[model samples]
Target chain A: MSDHKILQYPKSPYLKTSYYEDTAIQAFDTPFRKKCLVIGLLFWVCFPFVASSYVVHIANLSAIAAIGAMSLNLLIGNTGLLSLGHAGFMGAGAFTTAIMTVQFGLPIWIVIPASGIVGALLGLIAGLPSFQLKGIYLGLSTLAIHHIIKYGCSEYQYYGGFGYGIVLEAPSLGPLLLAGKTVWFFVLWISAFATALLIANLLRSKPGRAWSAIRDRDIAAEVSGIDIGFYKILAFVVSSSLISMQGSLYAYYTAVVSVEEYSFGLTVSYLAMIIVGGLGSVLGSFLGALLITALPYALIILAGLVDLSFAVKEHFSVIQTGVFGMVVILFLLLEPLGLVEIWRRVRCYFELWPFSYKPLTIIKR
Target chain B: MLLASIVVLAGIYALLGSGFVIIYKASRILNFAHAEIVMLAGYLAVSLAVAIPFSAASLLAVLCFCFVLGMSIYAILIRPLAGYSVLSAIILTVAVGVLLNAVGVFVWRGEMEVIPFGWRTYFSLPGNIRLSSIEFATLGIVTLFYACMGLFYRFTKIGQQMRATAENPLLAAQRGISIYRISGIAWGIGFAAAGLAAFLLGINYAISLQIGNIAVAAFVVALIGGLDSLLGTIPAAFIIAATEQLTITYANPRLGDAIPFIIMLMVLMFKPWGLLGTKEELDRV
Candidate 1:
């Protein structure tokens, strides 16, 4: 308790809460939280200008993935539910948007929301079983959902005739063109920012607290009078919506929606992003997506610079996957909280400066 | 011929499904890397066979290599991550699988290799039933492996320890058992079984980087059989395999992969713990 209180500044009115209080640190008056918000906003504003075309592309991709990862974190990280089939929800959104735009000639505004709604509806249906199940059973249930979606999309002729997937034209906002890397960068960033803000605000609300409670200990949360069923479904709905949003964005960015793009491998990659990002942390999701997405491209460029053999270059894809695995394992073994936690530590170190002490007591404090 | 081929495929599924069940039972984590281990073993066997002068010698060498590889994986990966969150362990195993797949692709350059198992003969049976030499060998080897496992568990002291650990690891530890050692042996055995299955599969089909996609059937089989029940795996594997074969042969060839997944979904909806899995075992952790 003393250690928890040590970081609190007595002069700050925001620090008056007892250290044992279970409420999240929501008081924005605190210097740390304020600084973080300011820095984040500044970065968002200037990101497009400062970032190179390749960097912008990576950032856009990361932003979309971040939203998806954040959504998954809500279920897995917050609610303690493991879902192996999230790509199904993303696929639902992607395919829905793809179908609407290509087949039905729907406008982007109508299609995007419809895609999210479709995703939420499917998520609700998939998550309905969670009310009766727990743990691995729940995980397997989601996995089933994943396979069903994959097979349904691939084998069935309803969405698109066999062997042909839906493709969309580049979107435009009224007279303003929203195409290429530049438009996608802005679109994904705005969506990512909105998602982050929504999640951050939700964390401050009662429902979010309920979700966190359910995550830490569902029995205790149930005992505390939280409707376990409602919150659990809500988590799925919200998370699925975000994932679907990402899916819609992904479809537009790539302009093609193929079963190959939404394979189990991609699901694994998304999970890896969440793990490497830091499970429950919003910032961790962004960091993890950036690392996982960029690492391969960076490695490929390095390999090219060294004039690697054709065989080696061909194999580099697998090697990249291996390195991703190794990074994930190393992170789990060394810092389970992930890169976000490491970043926090680095920030704290700089903030504390020369006053940092290495003694057990000081370190713990 | 198709029916016979279906039976052989079912037999292959049973082999892999049993391995998955063993690992899941002894250590309550789905080894996402299980398929990768199979791929690794297949590649290893092919590489070793190519290097060796004598075929029998190469087969023996491959088996020994698989055993050692399995043991090392347990020691290096599973043991350290013991007691961590099941989710973390699952992800870690998946990561390891990715790593193995990467290494395999890096070494093999993503090429499909034709493994020559030195058997091309087919035996005819009643009602147009015909089985290839490799299929017969696979079925025989699988039956022998299961028989050996059943006898080993029934008769051996280490086997009893494994059962105890699987039943209740904490309680087994209280009874002077080294749970870590039991878990290691379980992983070692599980990996070796996967290796054997991969080798058999490679003999029938071409081995490549994408062999892991085929191994996804193991999950459906494992689920249908009850992740904890060895006996259930065989029947479930056969049923799923039969469904896949029938769908492919009659309905649509493209639906072959999708059929197992459909069965998996149906099973999960109706009996999530599986046919043989008890409520207590199913809900643990």
Candidate 2:
């Protein structure tokens, strides 16, 4: 059933592997994957000098979003559990890191990991209900967490009073000053890459396979002796930890925290990134993050081209909100698999070149 | 005064919550955009009052206009999207909300406006339980609406069809019921109730493009009451309102919004199903 004429390709003159040998069918177990990782690392090392300050800022935002998106992917894409309150978990991490650093004068290293630990603890607590519930009930359960975080941060006097004022000093790792755009860019990328690596490895492990099994068929997985509850909680914890790390990095980058920044809208945006990128792929996470993060800037530039009156410019947020909604709907209707899937198809086409033929059975049954 | 306020808030929430239950039961969709519908109706009411002279005639006109708006939304958006996944429906409703918000901004120019309703002396009980005439009217109207809805569901064939649809869409369809028609009716009723609630809210507070903020409060009320139980919504609404009032009166007023959320979390942790919802009903979701 999986066989197709499009699987064939003209032999590469320079390489031993024939196009007919099914390069696409080869499992992701080549030294090429390692070389790709090395190149990615080299690019990051050189990013500080090669990229402009503004590009570095954008990269930082994408990295932070990637971390959060990766966490969400574990729950939604892998475990088939929906979370509407991921921003809340991120907020928990951010606020924890911020409060510790600002109030107790904790070191940067201590605060960052502390943020992840706090996030993981909160994730586990929040995820407990999933052991007993499924579907919309579980979704609402997570939503309740979001509201709780929002309310707690806004009203609870321990963090800051309900006026929504919370601020933190940027951190410095001893002699290595980790503030400004340069340091933020590197820190966020490192965090994102670490998260991606962890997710990749987890996906290849037993727990990851269990999560997929649960996602595909929970009853079958449970009947097969897989502990559904354990894997669900594990996914939630790992996802939450990554989100918290992102949150900590965000807090340190901006040196401030506001309840408004972690609203349901941010959660929606994160969901959009994953959905638009390709739900289960690591490449999809980064692609969705970069595209979504850049979309608003592109809109702003486009809006600038039109000679709008000052009054209209002030109301630009309304326009932006409308555009955001339109974009989400368009993607939902036109490309639900997101950009990564599209990128994969394009790569496959180019790789096959002259011998490529339409795959007759590629359409979903 | 506090007691009177709680009763009035309870009555209003009961009306809205019952409407939410009816719709959810029939469609199996939570209708997240219900709040946006309420805002739309409120805006329409304001427009009617402005376009026509403010009289008893104008009030009737506003109500009728809102009813039509409610029916039209069902026919246009809700009916077509029926039978899709609950998540897709949710995303669609959210999209509809965003669209409505944009329209509201354009219509109101993002300004806060007061709905003109002539006032009389504030009513009071012997124990110094003062209540505004508007509040009293709202409570009375809410009671009337709930009674009518209860009678309709118990006695009317259309109401029975709606119930059947809610209970089992496939079975209802097999029984020769038009699920679309039932859902459309549910949507209309839901929106009308939300409209009435929004009117009462606007009478007490100024209306703005951000009227959906109140919907969040309503959502918490609905969740606490249990998504399936209309009877449970009244007490849940009162509890939520009282908590907010007390938090403002005694605790820090800034914590008022957080109070409901804290209560929701506590309820969810202990009884993942809600105050009135059965575990079996929740498991299906």
Chain B TM-score, model 2, reads 0.91
Candidate 2 ranges with C-alpha deviation above 4 Å: A1-52, A156-164, A351-357, A360-365, B55-85
True contacts kept of each: 0.67, 0.45
The TM-score obtained by model 2 is 0.88
TM-score, chain B, each candidate: 0.95, 0.91
lDDT of 1 by residue, B114-211 (tens): 67877589888888888888889888999998998898788898888988888888899999999777777777788778888888888888778778
Error of 2 at A78 (Å): 1.2
Error of 2 at A297 (Å): 1.2
Residue pairs in candidate 2 whose N, alpha carbon or C atoms collide under 3 angstroms? A276-A338
lDDT of 2 by residue, A1-365 (tens): 34565457653443556544432323334666668878877998898789889778888888888888888988887888888889899888888886787679999899989988988998898789888877777777788888778777765434455255467766788888787898788778878878888887788778888998988778999999999999999988988888987888888888878777888878878887887787777888989888888777777889878898886787777777777666766665566667886887886777678985863334320
DockQ for candidate 2, please give it: 0.50
For model 2, what is the alpha-carbon lDDT of residue A238?
A: 89
Minimum summed lDDT over a 10-residue window in model 1 chain B is located at B276-285
Fnat of candidate 2, please? Answer: 0.45
lDDT per residue (tens digit) for residues A127-214 in model 1: 8889777887788788878877877777544435735566678887678767878777778888887898888778668888898888
Q: Which CAPRI quality tier does the interface of model 2 achieve?
A: medium
